[model samples]
Target chain A: MSGAHLLVRVGETTAALPAAAVRRVVRSLRLHPLPGAGEGLLGLAEFAGEPLAVLDLARLMGAAGVAGASPAVTVVTWIGPAGDRELVGLAVDEALEVAELDLGAAAAGAGEVLVAERPVRLVDLERLGEEA
Target chain B: MSPELVVVRRAGALWGVPAAAVAAIERGPEGVTVRLAGGRELGAEAVVGLSGEVSVRGLAPPVRRRLPPAVAGLALWNSEPVAVLGVAAAPAGGRR
Candidate 1:
């Protein structure tokens, strides 16, 4: 990891959603089905009595799951650009830790970015709304 | 306001089918199946639990489209989300 980032385990990928974009991390998101929602989208959740859309980070990354999965962690974050931002929960296998990721050191591309010692998928939180 | 609904659980989620439309609730190898008078079938992987009526609200377009046509709307039962189903298929692709 090089720059300030919040590392979360989304299936087999260790995704880094910018720390600034992360609102909060909660233990497990209880989800309801959004039957026609895209594969990456899970369903809905309530945050402070308000409806919240929960998206599966693993499904979005296209990996799906990791063996020996731990308890689920819901990362509430803002997706999309400012003025068009929305609060959405990104559910992952677990929240690893907040670390500094050095993208300049590794070869990263194709929807992935280099972090610390490995290349992890790069999630564009900004463009998420259109897909869900 | 919506009318009476027969609670049906399928594929690990709770579903609400209109009371008037249900012919019989049976248990077989496919798990709990809610057979409709119109010859439509709503099957579940888990056992069907028909409980009291639940209130339902129309789904937001984004939420409605992702689910199968069988899911009519949404309801909250026991603080859990329930997908209220309609007997007729939704307009498009509705595979689970």
Candidate 2:
């Protein structure tokens, strides 16, 4: 897969996750909530007979709540200690275009404004699993 | 080697879980829910409340609360006290 950064909005602010880390931006997928599941987890979905965990990115970043029937983009990254790839869906207010930027030039820790205006950070696919 | 751990900084505090312990990390109507190695799960309410970084109960604590020198370097993963599962007692010869 091409190495590019995906610019997305948690609410008003823009944040980026690596395009490579993202399996695909899906819409209108039925998100089922798991009993006693954590807050950030939207729920589990059976994609091709395999159950995948859906993650709420906005909830993770402390962003605004998504409105009803609004479109969301799911970024499926691998999780688990053994590097078992798990699909985690991030709920975003809007799905921005993908862009390619130099790693060094990509800003880090610039706060929400810088992220929306310019490429604020480099998305590390490996780290997503470790951190998620 | 153990599976890599993922570190997330929420609400100014850091927390980590064995990347393996995390079955999946997802955004929900509420907040970030981290599924553990087993079916057990924990919710980062702050992440759900959008309140920034906040702490919550996680996995069981390890028997050796203090990590050995060999694992000290891994302490960086403790951006916040991550929910850790306890280590089971080894058999006579250290067999699991």
Candidate 3:
């Protein structure tokens, strides 16, 4: 299926999220760590009067563990079906742009694609949120 | 004859995998996961690129002794030695 996708950089790789699942993109926001939050969960941030759970995409993807810096932006996303969705904020290095993606033609696992000759991984947001 | 290889950068070392054994290299939710010819998927930090052609030359055969459990053997590429990773030994979520 053809739909819009939000492209964001996580560490050295670029990843895409379904535009429909994304609420908005924001600059680095203060995150309050949640006690006992499991791995990959960065913390929580306030958005639309609600506490949005933030996740480190880099950590979730198990990329090279680089600890010196924090993500410079966040992509707020919602998971699950309508009316029962949960808000999540994904921390990323940069928010690139929205682009048209053919989900069918993308790679089977993680929906890989090439943009400007560089490979961009299209994340399965639903699966990612569920696993996290 | 030389073996065709795909060079990968994991942790801080370079590794080689026979190119024919790789089914697909895609971005995974947890990082770069390579689909092996056997259909198993494992995560990777970065895929350096294929080495094209590599000659074993004077290098000794991959020895069972003096090597880590995960490494299958040793080979020379660009005049340096690289570990031949046993992809099956890769962790569930890829190399940490």
When only the first chain is scored, the TM-scores of the models are: 0.78, 0.70, 0.85
- Per-residue error for A50 in candidate 2, Å, reads 2.3
Model 2: chain B TM-score vs. truth? 0.42
Error of 1 at A1 (Å): 13
RMSD (CA, Å), each prediction = 6.9, 15.4, 20.4
Question: What's the distance in Å from true for residue A7, model 2?
Answer: 1.5
Stretches of model 2 off by over 4 angstroms after superposition:
A1-3, A69-71, A79-84, A107-132, B1-96
True contacts kept of 3: 0.00
Ranking by DockQ: 1, 2, 3
List the candidates' TM-scores in order.
Answer: 0.54, 0.47, 0.52
lDDT of 1 by residue, A96-115 (tens): 88876555543346556665
Error of 1 at A57 (Å): 0.8
lDDT of 1 by residue, B1-96 (tens): 365667655545666777787788777866666678767776665534454665565543333435566666666655666666676762221123
DockQ of every candidate: 0.13, 0.03, 0.01
Put the candidates in lDDT order, highest first: 3, 1, 2
lDDT of each: 0.63, 0.45, 0.64
Per-residue lDDT, model 1, residue A124, is: 65
- Candidate 1 TM-score versus the reference: 0.54
